[model samples]
Target: MSAFTMAASAVGVKVTTTAKRASAKRATAKASSSAFSARKASLNGVSLAAFAAPSVAASKSSQIRALRSAVFAAAKADRSKADDPDAGKGQRVMIIGGDGYCGWATALHLSNRGYEVCIVDNLCRRGMDDSLGFNSLTPIRGIHERVRKWKEVSGKDIELFIGDVCDYEFLSATFKKFEPTAAVHFGEQRSAPYSMMDRTKAVFTQTNNVMGNINLMYAIKEFAPDCHLIKLGTMGEYGTPNIDIEEGYLTVEHNGRTDTLPYPKQGNSFYHLSKCHDSTNMIFCTKAWQMRTTDLNQGVVYGVATEETMMDPALINRLDYDAVFGTALNRFCIQAAVGHPMTVYGKGGQTRGFLDIRDTVRCIQIACDNPADKGEMRIYNQFTEQFSVNELAALITEAGKKIGLDPQVINVPNPRTEMEEHYYNAKNSKLQDLGLEPHLMSDALMDSLLKIIIEYKDRVDKSLILPGVNWTESASVGQQLEKAEKVKA
Candidate 1:
């Protein structure tokens, strides 16, 4: 053969080899895509086994991301078909703790806004009231009655699932079936006093709060990684920091290096500690699984009425004024109604963030309408105003006087082991920027809330108004105080 003929032959072989490799790459990509689709089909109860599952020839991270994306897409399609025709127009959201104080109100709020809502709860908080021999100052209807009343009042439907989130199988099934566009999580134990009541209560709180959230994160990853998880974290997670608290992260400069990290947490109670743990888990998951999350570090929620909740009497939300579940203002207002003096703990200088219930619902709506990007963990300080315990008591006293309740403010020995004085300047601009017109604490709101309290005054148990749980090692301090008050009487 001539030299030119040999070179031409070599060039032809090289071209054929290059073409073959390109063909192989295309085949691999196709196989990987098909295997992912088949897995998704199987998950959604579609039998697509005829397509052989092939090992995805991609990086480990790429394969995982692809699998998650496919699973979520299939789940979303399945959920869309199961929902009402109108549900497709609006985003479908699931509330994991949909039966509690905030959860119930949020369901009604979102439903009124035309979003499809599914509420999941095991009624553990209600059970806690029974276990602690405390009841809401206001009469609360059962979940079934509440849902029925919501439907009757607004002509909107809210799907309810009665189950524990700690049950992974149950949660997984719910996620698969609902395929929510977002999840508003409020399903954990939320009381600091209750958690510190006893060793058993402490263990239950930690396990219930942490494990349930972990299970939720896993279920989201496996079923719907794209679902924006809007967790109801407490401002208590940041405690009473001396420095101004950032939204959810802080920037540090050390050794000529600057890095941004999650804000330093200093939760004052076991309940708050559990929330910090959840935040850590979420941050890890956001990085490891590329999951999207929004942690709304909410302050103490006050007030009762919302647009949807006020539609009917039966649709009213639960109002707790006991030491365990009741907030400062709620308990104070109820106290004034029953002619009991406002029991201010310590010097009552403990200041914290606050928001009206009406605003809380609004904030959630804003968060839902605007979702976080994949692998992004968004945090919003979710309160409109701030007040010290003394200021709240004074406000309640002034309102009580207006209603002829003759409320008096009295200072009592502090039951819990928190600071009476601390700096709390947490930035809460994120939610406001999202167009949250805050309902500031005003006398009109106070008067309205007092009227309801007065109407339910007959049902108020004065005995349950006092603290039952002490944060210190000696749990009997609260009991001792109760006995002393009884003797003084």
Candidate 2:
């Protein structure tokens, strides 16, 4: 063939090859897989998998740039307007830990603000309830039932998924599916007492909390790079420090060099240590990958119900009172319900920050709508006030007395190695500026919690309410079992 004819043939082959390759890429992006998520994620980006910034260059054709721009724009908008402290609707949000107390409460708060919401959880709380004999300190419904009730009450439909976060396939699949603008992850083992229950519990806490976070970051990278991640951290990770607590970030003027470390997590127990590990791993990955993350350094949450949860019994979440999964507040509520005195661990002067359940949800939603930029890991201290064990007992006692029932305050020997008395000066201006109005632990909220428990009063088992799980120390599993046998003998 002539030179021109040969050149023309080569050009034709190149065009055909490139076009075929593009077609295959589109096909790959369009493929969808089954998700183990019981509350299946919506099909927003389920067909398209996530890619990184470096790879994005190669993928950034005019067509791909448009998609990227759109995704980034949506993410940016959600973060910028999430908290308008001026009293208005919040940003659209999806909560990964929406199955838990804070998670459910946060979901409801956002929904009230008219923000779109989707929740995904593996029903770990349900499993815990099943393993133990008693149910949530209050009547609880399954995931589907709860979602349905929310719909009935508010005419809003919250997309939900019941699946494990550690499952990368499932995590990625759900991320692609939801195309969520922002995500609040609360899915982790969160009890120091339980983590210290035994070695198995310790191992489970370590693996589950850390791995779940790792998997979540990976899923965000794989399925939604531009999506914002808001995570719940703990003040216990910082321990009872002599220094004042700065919400999530700290500034240092060093020797001609300055760097803000993650407030140096001096974790107290396995569970708190696991959260520290989670934050550490997250900071590393988020910085390396330029993923935006917000870590909420939250304190102990109290109070019974949110505005929505209080509106109906069916709308309430699993009100756990068991030692394995319950928080101090919920446990206290259950104690009041069963006519048992609140058990205050020894040296009840341990003061920590506290927030009502409604505030916990509000703080989480605020984080969601405020995405940190690339190379930024935003941190916020999520609490309104501080209270000691004795202080909380006094409040509970006063409220219980008003109801014509005396709620005793028993001094139980401390189980964990926490400071019974120490300094707890924490600043939480970020969330407040983000328009989070604080809800105090009011007598009304306590009454509501007590009333909810009263509905399920017959279901409360007074025997298994308290299990002395020592987290500050350890005894072998065999030794523990032998001791139990000896007790029986």
Which portions of model 2 miss their true places by more than 4 Å? 1-92, 253-258, 472-476
In model 2, pairs of residues that clash are: 38-162, 39-160, 39-161, 39-162, 79-369, 85-435, 106-361, 136-319, 137-319
Give lDDT tens digits, candidate 1, residues 1-489. 242243223223221232243243234334534654566556444222212345534555665565556565654453333222232233677998898889988898777655678999999888888877888776778999999887666666689889999999999999877777778999999999888876677788899999999999998889876677889999999988789999999999999999999999989888999999999999999889988789999999987788767777887888999988998888898888887888999989999999999888877876775567678899999999989999998898887888787888888888798999888788998875444667898998999999988888888889888756778853444665676799999
- Candidate 2, overall lDDT? 0.71
Alpha-carbon runs more than 4 Å astray in model 1: 1-88, 474-489
lDDT of 1: 0.79
Give Cα distance to truth, residue 323, candidate 2, Å.
3.0
Q: Candidate 2: worst 10 consecutive residues by lDDT?
A: 31-40
As a whole number from 0 to 100, the lDDT of residue 389 in candidate 2 is: 79
Candidate 1: worst-modelled 10 consecutive residues by lDDT: 7-16
